[model samples]
Target: MFRFLNIVIISLITSIVSAQGYYDVTKYGIPNDSTFVGKNAIDNIIQKAVQKGGGTIYFPAGKYLTGSIKLESNITIFIDAGAELHFSDDFDNYIPMVPSRWEGTTVINFSPFFYAYKAKNITITGRGLIDGHGRNWWNYSEGFDDKKPKSKWENTFFENNKNVLAPPDSKWLKRGFLRPPFIQPMYCENVLIEGITIQNSPFWTVNPEFCKNVTVRSVTINNPHSPNTDGINPESCSYVHISDCHISVGDDCITIKSGKDEDGRKQAAPAEDYVITNCTMLSGHGGVVIGSEMSGGVRNIAISNCIFDGTDRGIRIKSTRGRGGVVENIRVDNIIMHNIKQQAFVLDTRYAKSTIGPVSERTPIFRNIHISNVTANTKDAVFINGLEEMPIEDVSFSNIHLEAENGFDIHYSKNISLNNVFFSGVKTSLVKIENSSDIDLKYLKLEKSTEEKPWVSAINVDGLFIDGCRPKKGTKTFLQLSGKTTSNIGFGTNDFRNVSQVVVKDYDVKKDAILK
Candidate 1:
């Protein structure tokens, strides 16, 4: 009887909340005509809903032009099936430089089209579209374009500083030059964005910064081939879940970041506990990318059951020196890649141009990663380029198959293990090892192409072991050793066919290099 009474009480509360009725923007003096600007009317409606202890603000089947709409706690913005929210192209609409983070650095800039701050239990859901007419923004970023007119804000800002034409190379930029994101929620909790079609974002489409308990599902993102138009970027947030989304953008489909070089270390809020599954990626720079701005560190990430087609890179992790961070405990499984233009799997420690110096806390660290059950047809199979001062550590791959134009490139790494891995249709050496140590390969198979190169080449490697490796037919030399520092290489019982020489020294080094 107590449980029954509790259920009845909860149902009564829910009904009472629903009975508050939808606060239509048209009823609040906002017209459905496209000529009228609905910014004030929408803001008034949102305020009215908040005053009523939270309700739904509904937009029925029309095109509503607005500048920026701020959301409040316990409020839901619902657009009907045929309704479309069109953002104004004028730069003055996003005024009064709010406190925002631009690409991992904190600065006061223009407000996003849809902005929410420090609010809870907020949602934006419907079958309608939120469009950012971003052609003018994109053109201004690239320089003067004949198709777009110069905005008054742009003209005034540039007129004061006649020498400055565009944004500087630094990560942090002043106001009046930074383009805003489409939808941004900062320091909010219990956020849910579902079933909305977002297109032509000025910056990243949907960015949630410093938020928690966020869930984005069943959304569609379509950004044109413009600069910095990423699909969904979650920065310095925790407990994020993104699933069942279709994304086609110019930059990375889904990028996870914390912060940038010096500013990132100060914030020290790592992006953690993320789960991305059942997503389709097409025409992006990378399917899923981590860092370049991950100074606060990233951990406990799991990606599974995704498809990447016509992407530049399938899975990528990149960081440079001076970005002090540690990325660990990552697992990716059951991924399929087709027509990848670049490497299928890449861990680049030297992502961009940076001065090399002594190892310190500023140096980035990537380790403790496991990938399995992956199949890729790409141009390059795998590329691991770690820094010499701080090498990548403790990574493993199992049950993987790849067909690529080139092969694996491993450098400055340690404790790598590969089992049941196959490489086919490779024109270059099947595996190239450089400045690495403590490697193990088991049940490895290599199929050669027209280019007759050594199947395995090692330089300055120590404690290398190979077991049950099957080389392709008509191979002259199975192993090619170089550099004076190479030592302690061993091979177990393997299948060798039509090979003239088992080991060949490419340089004037020690003769006692191989052990069987």
Candidate 2:
């Protein structure tokens, strides 16, 4: 009986402590007025909560203007429905450079708007809005004229600290000065951010770097057509889950990256084990993009049930020769894309200004990717361009239906399989293969356009197999073979309706290169 009473007493004490853990900002002398700078007051309240062994910092219905607010471990910032966290416009407000990575390169620069370092079990959840007030930052970066004199803020800090303002020998300096991201949690674990509206981010929004087990759900990101306003970028992080989000931004909607160039190769941390689902992308460079900065490599990513509307590209994977990394084991299923301006699916090794050189550890590799059940209407069906030295390998597509202006183009790739893939409104050749080998096409259907190109064109190809491929009626040529290096080409059970010629040889080749 005594032990039972002791248990009850301990439970009561725990409940009482939990009830008393709510720290209201108003009670802590943080005014609701929009003019007040609440950074110090808010930090004090967070520290108080941490002293009490973790709690929630509750913001009532008010507009609180603040600078950079650092987050601590085991703390939650909960804003009420009518509350607005407006970040300050003063550039000096984010002083004291912090260790952060800007556009894939690690540097010590300005802190992010909502910064967290090495925090665990941290959450930023509420039905309120976090506004970056990023117009000044954007103008400083985008609208700056070199002939004009600098603004007072710029003259004071940016001119005084050129090293801090720009990355080391970065190409981004030609575009403009660097700006901080909206939210960045570096080396954090068990982070959760949900039910928040983020807008007008100066740079990439919701970037979690070197973090693990991060969850971002039900968040709405709205950034205008400004430069480098990516929606959600998970860099060098593992076990990330992002779902049920609506993203409309200037750059890519979701860009998975590790490091960039030499810095990335040194870090050698891959962004892996990601599950992104149920997201809606309205406008961006690409709906889902991997790299341009993925030198550290990426693997084991799964994206499904996403909708891409009016984006420049639907799904894109891009890297260059110097960004030495390997991206493998990616699975994408059940995606819908409409009115994409570029190719529905693109894998290009020549992404940015990086060029090919002697193949080394810096040469990027992309392989073992599977995409299925995708329907897209775009300007181009698919484009896979790999380097001549290091080719992309082991990619497969199944159950894909695309209506595009141009058909598929494959170059310098190997072991690619397409099953049950259909394309319509192709202005160019139905399928074009160049310098590739070990390709298998089954159940491929093509609805050709008015162009007089061949239905299938192969150049410098080897081990090409076409099974059950059907072209539309009144095609001129069924197959056009070119390049003396072509060999072992096979056509099995194909239907060529009213084709003018079965084969057209563009180059003189050896016998037994083409097989029926």
RMSD of each: 5.3, 4.4
Q: Give the per-residue lDDT of model 2 (tens digit) for 229-339.
A: 999999999999999999999899999999988888888999999999999998899999999889889999999999999999999999987779999999999999999
Give the per-residue lDDT of model 1 (tens digit) for 58-165.
988899899988899988999878889999998888876576777887665678988899999889999988899888888877664434665566555444434422
Query: What lDDT score belongs to each candidate, Candidate 1 first?
Result: 0.85, 0.87
Clashing pairs in 2: 324-362
TM-scores for the candidates = 0.90, 0.92
Q: What is candidate 2's CA lDDT for residue 47?
A: 95
lDDT of 2 at 211: 99
Superposed model 2: Cα runs more than 4 Å off: 1-20, 144-169, 173-177, 353-355, 448-451
Q: Show the lowest summed lDDT stretch of 10 residues, model 2.
A: 159-168
Off by over 4 Å in 1: 1-18, 144-176, 447-451
